[model samples]
Target: MIDWARVGELVDEIGAEDFEEVVELFLLEVDGAISALEAAAGNAVIVEEQMHFLKGAALNLGFEALAQLCLKGEKAAASGRADVVGLDEVRQIYRSSRLQFERDLPDRLAA
Candidate 1:
């Protein structure tokens, strides 16, 4: 669900001083995207584009579980199978991933 190593790499690459800002930006942007996704629901075009964006952002943040779901939805939408993609499930996974990431990041980073 979370990739601690990748998260550490990102923190190192971006520098600790700027990590919080990055986290804020991530949450802000991802929240907007998720809202758009909800509005679009199973719309193919929106799902394809939004899911692609979500997948990349999620992977960058080490939200592997969310990224995987986004990838699957993106592919399905791209293939004209948008109906099979569960937007609710995607949102649920993101919410869950975010919770876990928030809960564990401090300890994991300190360690």
Candidate 2:
């Protein structure tokens, strides 16, 4: 599960204005990379690149589970093992994490 406490602390440290900006940046990067990864299919280079970017972004956001998924994707892609089906699992996790983040953020701020 996502760590709401850490997220709350991060929001408190950054302030609402800065937090919004960072979230926007994160969304842009994640959206773009996910799209590219989907389009690339079996292309190892593209998959690895997208996963690498996602790994870094997730790490920076303190999203440990998402970051770990990205790390696995990166290793798989690096090995030239194109498991397109497995990518869907990663996508699902990403979507779930993102949705949870969005849903919890406002409540955290309100509190």
Candidate 3:
């Protein structure tokens, strides 16, 4: 669900200070994207767009669970199965992963 190795690599690539800043941006941006996704519920086109954007962002940040959920939702939206997409699960997974990243990122960066 979470890709700690990728996260570590990102921290290393960007340096700790920049990595922290990037993480903050990711959290804030994804929070807004998730809210947009929730609000787009029942609208397949909007849902697909929201999920597609979120998927890319989540992948970059190693939010694997959220990315996977977004991928699923995006595919479903494309197939006109948007109603079957689990928005709640997406939200839950995102929240859990976000919390995990927030809690562990500093330590990981320090390491």
Candidate 4:
């Protein structure tokens, strides 16, 4: 889920224009990471690396749920259980988070 407070703080610090740019860049980066993650398949090391990167990025943007998922996946992958990560679930969460973020962002920012 999106953290409106964190988003607000970020917007306050960077202004709307820059925040948008950051969000755009973040989405692009995450998309690439997700693609790589999918391609990693059952490679535990690759999954761990990608999940670690994703967790950090998600945390930075206050995508709390996604971050948690990434952390779980990271730990699992670290333990050589990449199959537990379940790419479908991760993709679903990301899509949901993205939809909610896009839907509520403008209103939240205006408020």
Candidate 5:
């Protein structure tokens, strides 16, 4: 879920303080997106848009698993199939990924 190398590179590119800011912003945005996605359950149109945005954000932050899950959700939504992607599982994964990033980012930035 967490890509340490990418995190390191991000920190190097953005500087530690800016990296933290970006992480915080990402968390805030993604949390909202997750909520929107949950509320959009069974709504293929909304789900597709939400999942697409979330997936792109996740990829930028190196949340590979979350991004892949979102990709699945996006495709399923595009196909008009609700059963293919589990929103609950996606939510859980997002929460786990958020927690892991919050816990690990400091040390990673310090490094």
Candidate 6:
């Protein structure tokens, strides 16, 4: 299950007035990065670069699960494990996490 208390804490840290806009922007960027990483999985360098970007972005946004997955993908890509299956798994996890984040965002912002 998602940690909504952590989400609330993050929003409070970032300032409630700007929380919604920032969350929306982060989600949009993360979604696009996930797509790019999926499409570039055949190229190890590209995949690694995308994962690195995603890792930092997720971490900064306090998206712990997404950050962890991106770190795992980065490690795998760095070690030359940029296979289709691995990329697909990352994409699926990203999608699931994104959905959960969206579902809980309203409450976080309201707080």
Q: Write one digit per residue (lDDT tens) for candidate 3, span 71-108.
A: 98899998887776677888889889988987886787
Candidate 2's residue-wise lDDT over 12-102, tens digit each? 8998789889888998988888888889877988888888999888876667688888888888888986563367777787889888888
| lDDT value, residue 72 of candidate 1 | 91
- When summed lDDT is taken over every stretch of 10 residues in candidate 5, the lowest stretch is 102-111
lDDT of 4 by residue, 1-111 (tens): 887788888888998999889999989988998999989978999999999998988887778888999999999999989988788988999999999998988788778
- 6: Cα error in model 6, Å: 4.7
TM-score of 1: 0.94
For residues 1-111, write the lDDT of model 1, one tens digit per residue. 998899999999988779888888988988988888888867899989988999999999899999998899899999988767687798789899999999999897788
Q: Against the true structure, whose TM-score is highest?
A: 4
Task: List ranges where model 6 is wrong by over 4 Å.
Answer: 1-6, 108-111
RMSD after CA superposition, every candidate = 1.0, 2.1, 1.4, 0.9, 1.4, 2.5
Give a tens-digit lDDT track for model 5, residues 1-111.
987787777778998889878988998999898788778758889889988999998988889899999999899889997557787888889889888988887776666
Q: Global lDDT for candidate 3?
A: 0.84
After aligning candidate 2 to the native by TM-score, how far in Å is the CA of 80 from where it should be?
1.7
Worst 10 residues of 2 by lDDT: 81-90
lDDT of each: 0.88, 0.81, 0.84, 0.89, 0.85, 0.74
Clashes of 5: 0
* TM-score of each model, paired residue for residue: 0.94, 0.83, 0.89, 0.95, 0.89, 0.76
Candidate 1, residue 2: lDDT: 92
lDDT of 6: 0.74
Tens digits of lDDT, candidate 6, 10-70: 6778777777677778778877887887678478788888888888877766667777877
Best by lDDT: 4
In candidate 6, the residue pairs with backbone N, CA or C atoms under 3 Å apart (3 or more residues apart, or in different chains) clash, namely: none
Clashing pairs in 2: none
* Backbone clash tally (model 3): 0
On a 0 to 1 TM-score scale, where does candidate 5 land against the true structure? 0.89
For candidate 2, give the lDDT of residue 22. Answer: 89
